[model samples]
Target: MTVDLERAAPAAPPAPPRRESRIWLVATAVTAVTVLLIVYPLGRTVLGVFGIGADSTVGRIGEVLTSGETWRLALNTVIAVSVGSVVALMIGAVFAWINERTDARMGFAARMLPLMPMFVPSIASAIGWVFLASPKAGVLNGWLRDVGGWFGLEMVEGPLNIYSWPGLIFAYVLFLTPYAYLTISSGLQSLDPALEEASRDAGAGALATFRRITLPSLRPALGASVLVTVTMGVAIFSIPLVIGTPADIDVLPVRIVHMMTHSYPGDIGGALGLSLLVVAAVGGCWLVQRRMLAANAHATITGRSSAEAAVTLGRWKWVARSAMLLFLLLTSVLPLAGLVLVSLQGFWSAEVRWGHLTFDNYRYLVDNELVWAGLRNSLVLAVVCASVAMAVGVLVTLVLARRRGRVASTVDAIVKVPSTLTHIVVALSFIVAFAGPPFDLAGTYLLLAMAYVVLYVPQATFYATAAYHQVGPQLSEASAVSGAGDGTTVRRILLPLMAPGLIAGWSLVFVLMTGDITASSMLAGTHTPVVGFVILDMWTAAGYPKLAALGVLMTLVSSAVVLLVMTLRDKLLVVR
Candidate 1:
């Protein structure tokens, strides 16, 4: 019976039949759409940057780089970015270390608080800082003045100027520290805990152990933090536009926008030219970092963690815990408090007394033309942009996953290019690409939405790719065996599993888009003044109280929306 079992049956060979025209038709349609959406804008923009038209726009690029004024703007941008990034890294690293080493109830909250700023729009945070730190009518200054008045000390001067370089730094640090923390925190979590214990058991002092064992081990993450912070800090435009503008500090991005919009006959050539140069410079650093990452000898670990390294703080445990809590409170709670105080005031700058504080600012916000319009525009744009970006995310992720070699690598590089360049450059590039070209999407919500998709697609794609890789081909193969079609398998199986990553990606896009100022400044039509631009207009018009009011309104709206999303994700999309 055992010898003859295989002779009873013979398997049929698979039949080769006619190929479906529908498959080719669908593939062509997808390729056409991809070319139109991804390739066209980028290609047209590059050509416009090189002055492809009879107007000879290409020469402007050389002129922009050679100009002295452009140099100064570049210098200023470098300084601001450099300083703000240093501060962010130091803050993030210290807090992350504390959270890792200290045993305290507040450790979780410490990590969460740093992440709080990432949830708010950069523009909103700028407004909040202004409310708290403004020289003339800031809540902190008011408090200092009232106390000083009783003591006969001069606390409030002619104007309390926080809208300077320091102001910009504070705002940027508030916004970007969280990014550093999260990235480095993950890095810290990946290292083996036994290494620290081994060092201690070898008679190494805690300080020595940290310096030799922990810090050295964390070098990769530290480098990543520096690179991430520097790139992002330089590219940041919104924080500068809101905080640096009042003091007339012209960073490169701001200068580019000014040249394009306010200059004679709209110096589109010069702006695009400058944008091309700036994009090259910033994008170059990003590329170098990517190369370093690509060339790394050691493999990095990233996955779901059941355990995290926790160092015994011993005598310094309390001290470490206190410092972490204090830092979190100062960064997150204080800035938010400032926004609250300003929102309650009728006139945030003119009066320095509690008697002047009223619910009038909040009341005025509801009825104000600018506030209403800005809120409507911001919500609409964020929703539209997030949707478009998520859709692009799905397509890009699929391509990268299915073809995971040079295609994935190339897409990763190109997609991240916009994030490295300042938003002003992107806006300018769009202007050049769409204003007069074979495809002009200027002055439309479509342009802004597309810009957002380009800006955020990198995050979505990277996260989605990781999710897709984690899922692997086994499940898809099983589905095929069960007679499931490609589209059906992807829709019913792949997308559901990608929910968490997609949610995270969409949240990042939402955060950046809602806070955006640079791109919106160029693309926002008369009918659509986004919240970021509205804040800029109000601040420039010297409407401090109104700006504060608007900031409060936007903060509440953003916090509510984010919370709702998290709740839904936890309940419905529990892929994690």
Candidate 2:
């Protein structure tokens, strides 16, 4: 009398062997492309370094490893990164704790603090600092000199030099702080408040409870933040190029750049050597963090609301608020004011002649052939690369989400390969890989675009994965039942639902590419001038006003593009 529903239901046919084979072949092809894109550049460089034609190059590796200059490079790099990471972590963690837990929150403004670097290019920020803190012409120095005059402490030069070690480290910290804040703040939001309440019930003070419970719980965040800060500091070229180069405080990235660009015959050998060292260091940190994460360095309770009563700071609340304001001023207000004033000054000078300020620099931006070309190239490159990368990311994410087994595993591993490398290292590898021989793509938009896609694919994939997971699978299943194939379902249902996220990912890459200097520094040339290259050219020509104006223009253009993408996404979603 059993219903036997399983037997009564019609059996679904298994996937055909030819279709399955085609799927495998497609996955293999995708894997091959991913490997070629991510690995070929770096592998080509290393192979060239050790090949027969590279006898001198291989020998130079030993020379570089054994020399006093190399030691100074390593030592200086370590000191800068170590100090910068700690200071950045402290400032960022303090900001996160205050904003997330204390009564000093500033609502939406506080949330935007971590996104400081996205639009405000680090190169622009560093140049602004140079104009603000240069020994002779720094505006801040001028103000200090005027202040010191009242106290009769007269001096012609600075008590502050942005060309010094402090200056270099300060520049690094400014960029790194936001990274630390983001990770730590996310950790703070995820922690369970019940544990802290228990600690309070046990008669522990706020500080004591935090030390015992919160700090230990946040080790994962702290460790990840430090890793990011140190790696980024090591790979940073702008601070070192703008500040360290003049100060004679050489770091690895600047050293790499010098070997490639400063000499008539570029020291390709030496640059490759340093790049490998950076790769090793970054790879080691990534591996260590991965293991730590796997081993459960810390754990947090999830699926509960993170809203908790703000801890009263008593009279200290005002101090916390003041700290937030100071952060805002340092990271945003002062740097922006410096750029604005310098652009108006027409030349680099301490005294801002309000009446003499002109719009000639702005005019130059509009009129100059090379500058205008560079701006246009950067914009086009950003848009095109973002579109292509998002397309690839979505395709890869779909494969991983919908399929299973060895192919998926291979694809996942291949996609994450770029995450272990620093951008400048990857940029250098691209130069070595394609600047000669069969592939001679150097100085072309295709070359820069390929390098950008490689450098940012990991990020794109991560964002795409998040987007895929956000939508339910039931929608796709329903569409299949209603006779939609994979392509039709993706085109009609998935794309619309995924538009906002995909566009957001696009905006991130667009912003980065439009203002990018690391890759552009190595790969961009006269034929394929980009905003970053022009900015560097301005630096060399002593055209401070034009430099500032161009930087401001680049930032504004990037912001506009991001806003436009978002607007289009909204309209498209509404239309669909």
Candidate 3:
């Protein structure tokens, strides 16, 4: 009996080390790949700023670190990113709490179907608001001024200004809220109800319970939201370019682009040097987030968490619903309304002459070869990029599922870092690393595809990891016991089970790459033009009517995709 028991102990020990060894192998492999593909490029750019090894005539002898203007722009950039993230975070957290903790009859995506607005290229949102609130001839401002006479408060262009600091922040909040809402709402839905219920049973009121128990538990989500806002704030170009530029507000992103595009030799040193500040800022934020995560892990999600004990809002539910609808109105209805009206007009004007409206913009879109070529290219690239990224995600996740330890934990954190990096930084890195000489991939779709895959693979990894965890290790083990090989197990068991999540992730990636502006603006040229570049060109040419038409079309396509995903969710994601 003693010998048999000792034999069994040795057997169990052997199994664990083998599993652990596999995990370490995976973690090491993933780390090496990311360092080469993602980190190496970014690091190369940083080095080039100081006249290190670079093929381009970027940092000549005395030119390195000479741009004092970059330092000046950094101040305004810091202020805008900081303030915008805070305000956007507040709005997002408030809405999340109302939807999850209170008795509000609304969900950001579930019931409202507001993703249509969220999916619209942020460029459209910025431009739409410009039309709605610009001082001279804004649609809403004009209406407001017309109504102001009744109150004897009539003044031209005194009501609103979309070209000011406040306007920039507002646009940022609108653009960022969806990301925060998605992150925080998922966190809230996954919290343990027992803790909140215990607080209530101990005679705590709803507000007190929330302040003490709920808020503490939501630290991870809140931290993630803050990071998302900060990253978006740093990378965001559309609103600042359209709204802030008019007001002479030179943020870092705009400055970086101007250094590259507005100069003759293209000030690569100054541009990349400016990009380093963004890197430092992100690195600092990430450090803080990691510390917060480590210190506040008591509220972490497990597989067994139950539904929350929702607080009753009673009559206030209507008020909550109205507030949500009001957000939708501002984000989707107002912007789209403005786009439609402007597109139909001959030019942007406060007075809408129905007889003067024309469809010339739409006709041009249909007739132009570049527009069709851009659309086709974007479509093909989206599918290809998403597939490649997700394929890598699945491979990493499969290895991760084989074991669980410190190495696996490290691997998880490392995978998510790419998603946190600014898209502009990613684009600039790709340029500095692969755009010249040995690569000479400057104008090729292959370079663009690689950038998209590297930039977005983290998101794909996240979705794949979630799906894998949901299936758990039991099924995979069972398949192994039944004599199925790895490929067979993945095909017959894991893929089918993970389909719902994979589909959702693929859909997100598809839309994101198609409407991408930051990378497209920097990396793509006329030879390989994308939809984003086309839109930006129209903006440059002051073709407001044509821009509006294209913007409206993009919105419709986005909305249609969102609707299709929703409809398919019912049939495909069912757990029967």
Candidate 4:
């Protein structure tokens, strides 16, 4: 009996304490923030569309749905998006083909040219083009009219009206072609040239080979580029606001803004309802794009590339080079030069003479209190928003990479949802959800910063995810096995590896947020003046010179920041 008691009294093994994973904790925090900032606000907007929210009225949505004006706005949006996307596709396709295939002059320069437009803000470009194409006092139009007069042709006072639909399309094509070029050029670079060579050896002409082989091979990229251009054309706000507003043109985005800000008592329901249409259009395009991509698995090329010769353009190479240079000039250099010239002018006019050119506008911008305040606010917003976005995006990327569950994917999708909605739609959603009662943040800098974060988190996540994929997962696992917690692993191993991407993401968001007019127009007010809002105010008040001056300042600041970030990114890569 004593032996049995001793055996029974044997010590029980000590139980280990349950430890929660830091990854899960981070994932949960990111999810909560995303839902609060993105999902909740968007839900508020959707509810408003159905006239089921605090700011909504019964039958208002129905009225919007049945209104002829709504139909007309939808038509205008479709037309603009279609025509602009087509132009972008043609320009991007030709550029990609010439640069990737031909021995064009300045080949390296042409490849880099598409990225130059990225530094120029869309609002700034619109303003610049307006100065060059506006009916009343456009430099280019005046020159064109003068040339016509020499030919004894009675041309209209202003032959080129940038306020019209054609002008809108032109501006959109200029803004959107860069994106198309990037996508298509990357695809082109990856394409296997063996097929083209074989076709050429079989006596197929270049045009024939392109039509049968190259074009079909590029269908996926082409389609994706088209979808992207269309999406941007549909979602863009600043271009339409600057060019279309003066002409009394009411595109869907403009109409949405008008309804929310200008309508009596502010028709939140109607605006939300209108936003639903935009969402539907973009969503439909996205669906079709996905289906098209998924249905056609064109795996013509793999990672390996055979030694293939570049296409011999011969005499056509110079023509191709000229086309590339001309495209770059019209899209990036000209608009920027126009902005600089306008900023230096004493008064904005068709004539560009030494007497008309003065530094008064720049001086005025320096002297203006509003300009100083707006710049300060913009810097703060860009820095804070970009830092926060990159931080959150890194955490989410970690969870997405390490966690093996549906929750991670769902959370990733949730984070990307805001990207599909237009900036104005996102801003309106924030206004509806957080502008009152609990979590009231209206007219505050925090609100504007939050909107920017929400708008840009998707981009940050994309860059970080790409970086995360580049880093081997075994390293993280080894760190964990070494008793390093998830937080410590991220701080040491992951952060160091992700430095390039984080820096790049921060730079991109900073540049975009600094010049973003759509969200700023909707979210900012006197209490929280931003650069974009200030520019808009200047434009609205017919302060063209001041607006151009501000545009020039924004361009300089953005370019400096971008250059610094690029140098830092290169250094980080070298260190890694």
lDDT (0 to 1) per candidate: 0.70, 0.79, 0.77, 0.81
Error of 4 at 383 (Å): 1.6
lDDT of 2 by residue, 162-268 (tens): 99989988988888898789889978888877777678889999989999988878877776886777777787787788888899888888888777777755777
Clashing pairs in 1: 50-58, 51-58, 135-160, 434-440
What's the best-to-worst order under lDDT?
A: 4, 2, 3, 1
Off by over 4 Å in 2: 1-32, 49-56, 294-299, 567-576
Candidate with the larger lDDT of 1 and 4: 4
User: Each candidate's TM vs. the true structure?
Assistant: 0.86, 0.90, 0.89, 0.90
RMSD of each candidate? 4.2, 3.6, 4.2, 4.8
lDDT of 1 at 518: 76
What digit string (tens of lDDT, one per residue) describes model 3 on residues 279-336?
Answer: 7888878777787788786834443333246677799888877777888889988988
Higher-TM-score candidate of 3 and 4 = 4
lDDT of 1 by residue, 176-292 (tens): 788888878877777766677678888998789889877766767876776678767766767777678887887877777777656555687777766665666566666665666
Candidate 4: which stretches are off by over 4 Å?
A: 1-24, 51-58, 105-108, 147-156, 195-205, 208-219, 298-303, 306-309, 477-485
RMSD of 2: 3.6
